[model samples]
Target: MTRQNVSIVLIVVLGALLLAVPALAAALGNPALVGLATRVLIYAIAAASLNLVLGYGGMVSFGHAAFLGVGGYVVGILFHHFRFSEPLFGVIAGSDQLLVVLPAAVLITGILAAGIGALALRTSGVQFIMITLAFAQMLYFFFIALKTYGGDDGLVIRRRSALFDLDMRDDRTFFYVVLGFAVTFFAIYATVIRSRFGLLLGAIRQNESRVAAVGIAPYRYKLAAFVISGMGAGLAGALLANYQRFVSPDMLHWTKSGELMMMVILGGAGTLFGPLFGAAALISLETYLTQWTERWMLILGPVLILIVLFMRGGIAGLIDQLLRRLK
Candidate 1:
């Protein structure tokens, strides 16, 4: 078979395995395994969103996790107020419905990203990174001081958001819900990266001056990409909050942004499926390694460094080279 055919087959097989995870875990009576798989999918979504800017648009944002936290807080805050029969901002009523909460999360995060990107895109390189980080830290502190939603203690959810009467409390059902969203996000990411907009964003990444010389506005394109990326991360955060039934200030911490970037790089920055692979690899390593020792990060640190030094493009890149050699 040709290399392309082989890859298609491999992807099909991988999809089948991922789809079977919840069932397999259920059969083995391992809820934790199911939960872990769900977490991986959620993180994959977040990393893929980050990849849109970091990998393709050449925007190094260290505050991407701010969206994640924002999304989670949207759900948490809404639910908290709903539980207490309170109205948000004395205008909008709280909701426990996924339909309402999810879109709100995405919308709010997208707006926040647009505002931040407007300013951050004016600068380049380290300045862009620092500005993004500063914005994210400011959001983090704001959440911590909100006190109404448990503040530093975080918010606890007593029930999952209503999903048209689906039994979201069941682990298997929740896994499927998360998996569906992950697939949808991947589809959207693929479409975005292949579209004309994606091409322009990529060209800007390669040479903003050249793109601008052609009458294209690089700032506008980059800002749109940034907003879309934030929306994706926000959706993932909402799913994560639903999955864990909790939201905390830590979700917006700078380190979480680092983790999302690490996943994108570890998988293969520009590749479509890179974030998924990266999340699986990193999370699996953490899960298995921690069982052996508490210093799993020490081992993971070296592994990441070695991959950067030797792998060049990461796992996806390594696989591509092997396929090329075989062809």
Candidate 2:
């Protein structure tokens, strides 16, 4: 088969496998896999969003985790207020609806990203990375100081948000919900990368001077991409908060941002489905390694380094090469 055919087959197979995960886990009496898969999907969303800016736009945001934390806190705070039957800031009311909370999380995160990107976009190279990290740390500390929402201890989401007739509290159900979002987000990401705006963004990444010389403002495009990426991360954060049943400042830590960055790079930064594969590979590796030994991370570090060293485009790139070999 040609590599293109193999690629098509691989995608179909992946979809089939994702759909069967719940049933497979149930048959094996390993319900934990369902939750694990859900977590993987959520991180995949975040990693994909980061990939948009870092991979295509050449905007390396080292503090992307702050947006995730922002999304989670939005949900957490809203739930808390709703549970207490209290209004937010003595006027705005809380919401337990998934529709309301999810959109709110994405919108709020996008707004924050716009504000931060306005300044961060002005710089480039290492300076951009450092500024992003600083902003993230500041947000992390801000959440830590918000004592009303459990502060450093984090807040528990006792009840999951309402989603029409679906019970999000159920692990399998939640997994499917997340899966749907992941699939939808990937479709949208693919479309965006193929559109005019996406083409322009790539041109800007390759030659910013040329794009600017043509009278096109590169800043606006970059900022737009950044905001969209942040919104996607926010959606992932809300899903993760629901999955973990908790929200904390740790979500916004630099290490979390680093992990997201690693996923994008590891999965093949410029390719569609790279983040999903990266998330699965990293999370699954860490998870299984932990069961084998407490030093799983020690093993994982060298393993990842080896992958980066040998694989041309991370896992996705390696797969393409192998498929071509078969062809």
Candidate 3:
């Protein structure tokens, strides 16, 4: 078979396995495996969103985790208000509907992304990175001081946001919901990467001056990509909050941003499906390593360095090379 055919087949097999996770876990009599799968899927979505900017647009944002926290807080805050029958900001009422909550999270995060991107885009290289980091940290501290939502103690969600007759309380069901989002995001990524805007973003990444020479304003396109990326992360965060039933400032921490970046790089930065594979591999590795020792990062740190040095394209790139050799 051709390389394209092989790739298609591999993706099909992977999707099949993901879809059958609940049943496979049940047959193996290890239900917790589903939860692990769910975590991988959620992070996959977040990491993929980051890849759009970091991998494709060449924008290394250190504050991507801020959207994750924003999404989670939106869900938690709304739930808190819904329970108390109080209006948020004395105007907007709270909602427990996933339909309502998820969109609100996405909208708010997109707006935040646009505002931040406007300023961050004015700088490049390390300046851009530090500015993003600073903005994220500022938001982090703001959340820490917001006592109404448990502040640094975090907010506990007593119930998952309700869907139309869907029993999200069931681990398997929730896993499937998250899986659906992952799949949908992959589809969107596939479409976007082939679209005109995607082409422009790629050109901008290669040479912003060239794109500008072609009469396309790089800032607007970059800002749009940033907003879309943040929205995707927001959706993932909303699902994460529901999955864990908690939200805290830690979700927005720089470490969380680093993990998402790691996932993208480890999986193959520019590849469409790399984030999913990266998240799976990293999470699985972390799980096994932590089981053996609490200082797993000491081992992980070196391993990642080696990958950066040798396997510059990451695990996805490595697999592609092997496939080419076989062909």
lDDT of 3 by residue, 1-327 (tens): 998899899999999999999999999998988989999999998999999999999999989999989999999999999999999989999999999999999999999999999999999889999999999999999999999999999999999999899999999999988888788888988899889998888999999999999898899999999999999999999999999999999999999999999999999997888998899999999888988999999999999899888888988898988999998
Best by TM-score: 3
Candidate 2: lDDT over CA atoms?
Answer: 0.92
lDDT of each: 0.92, 0.92, 0.93
* Alpha-carbon TM-score of each model against the true structure: 0.97, 0.97, 0.98
The CA lDDT at 50 in model 2 is 96
Residues 125-234 of candidate 1 have per-residue lDDT tens digits of: 99999999999999999999999888999999889998988999998888888898888888878998999999999999999999999998899999999999999999
Instruction: Give model 1's TM-score versus the native structure.
Output: 0.97
Segments of candidate 1 deviating more than 4 angstroms: 27-29
TM-score of 2: 0.97
- Residue 261 local lDDT, model 3: 94
lDDT of 3: 0.93
